[model samples]
Target: MKRVMGCHLEIEVIDPTEVELQVAVSGAWDDGQVVESLRCTLDGRAVDVREVRDPAGARIHVLDAGPGRLVVDYDAEVTGRARPATGTAHERSLYLRPSRYAEADKFFGFAATEFADVVEEHGDDAAVLLPYVAAWVGSRLDYVPGASGPTDSAKDTLLAGAGVCRDYSHLTVALLRALGVPARLAAVYAPGCDPMDFHAVAEALVGDTWHVADATCLAPRSSLVRIATGRDAADTAFCDNHGGGIQLHVSQVHAIVDGPLPGDDLAELVAIT
Candidate 1:
């Protein structure tokens, strides 16, 4: 279904010295369609915006601001479709490699033993492999909000058996990569999410397309609005500061669905631009 999704983000940087501020939280991409309805306002005033291509080819807007309030109000109309064709060879190669958060190489031994049968049955079919991994990983962990941090790795989450959405995505991505499937981290705005905030999920290369796998299951995948894609959370971070001492003030994210959302039974992996 066609939908309009967006968010209002406000961040404050409290740095007495010189610092560079860069944020990626406005671009709503889907199937190569530009965000024709995007509008951003910084610190109650309009600020110039710059675009940069992320690893997944999504346009991540960059804003430059000094020590002050950085507020962004943005909205966009995006039409999502079924997860289609695989990404370019570069996307596959990059996602297949072990990343800082998704250390797939390190989880190779564990994944091989735990999912030996699933691998044998599904082989390299990412469609089957993804759900198998998602269910297994979801069962292993207990969702605990503050149990993990940004620097936490899949190895860390696996050992702990508990983590937030990011941890779930990391472990899932790690396992998929260990099985020789290309997977990446995806940050999104979940409209029907329980806690109502930015959510993270994993996407795997299946056939010739990318598919979403949210092990947490807190939000329906069909209602997710793509924020950014990356090798890990580091690459898809909402805010990246070059040098500064900052504190986030009243950060909020929400998606106003145009109408009723599809049920989980009908939800499918959506293609994000």
Candidate 2:
């Protein structure tokens, strides 16, 4: 078994004149299987937190007035439960449900022809289809920062041919859905990741478990720390609050596996807020 950990934030109002603010954050993960427990602190004081589980669970939080600094701490132990693929017709049907397919109009412009060819060639196997599509996106799209957003259509990314991680994941999801695979987007903060920048990836149900694949990462065997997942990005956004001015300043992140622990470090696994 392998363990992965990280934290992410969505700062809506960064430069708020008033220190007191109400913040809503979704996608906190701390279920026994993936995460053990999650604790949140605001303005140096701990506040009551809540949890709700649905297809789209409430990893969300409503924060009351506080001080200048907001700190969050999280820990999780990932038990590597290898979701071995079950070659069954029912699994194939579940993956190919009509709801999984994206609207015909939303196909990526640059890879539309090639994506279509992939579907024509391997639509029958969900397991085979996912890796092929993920690798295709990874190799085809160049990672350019400040390129696009969650709602940016696949056509836009393909035309520009350069995008951030989210754009790449979005394009991959769009293509997977177009090919009738039930794919979703995930938000996570990787260890050594810039505090201000959250990570996004793609997930698809294969057999009885959800298999994760990130076109941006491009390694099938690498372990990923998952925060939240949904049909798309709209469902798994990080910091979401209204009526406050926000500002974000981030430094470059460095990944170190074995080093002296820093007391100020955010968290070992992904934090929802």
Top TM-score model: 1
Prediction RMSDs, each to the true structure:
3.3, 8.0
Candidate 1 clash pair list? 30-273, 31-273, 85-208, 85-209, 86-208, 86-209
Please identify model 2 stretches exceeding 4 Å from their true place. 2-4, 8-42, 56-58, 66-68, 79-104, 108-112, 149-151, 189-197, 218-222, 243-245, 249-273
- Taking the tens digit of each residue's C-alpha lDDT, what string does model 2 give over 1-273? 345454423222344432221112223333444544444554556656554443443355445433344554444555444232222455445433322222323553433476667667766355766777877888888887777654575667777888877777777777776666666676654444433255777666665455666677632223334555655555565544445554433222222222332232111211122
What are the runs in model 1 whose C-alpha is more than 4 Å off? 16-43, 79-85, 266-273
Q: Which ten contiguous residues of candidate 2 have the minimum total lDDT?
A: 264-273
lDDT digits (tens) for residues 50-154 of candidate 1? 777744445666656666777766666656542443588888899999999999889889888998998888778787888788888889999998999779999
Q: State candidate 1's TM-score.
A: 0.85
Give the top-scoring candidate (lDDT).
1
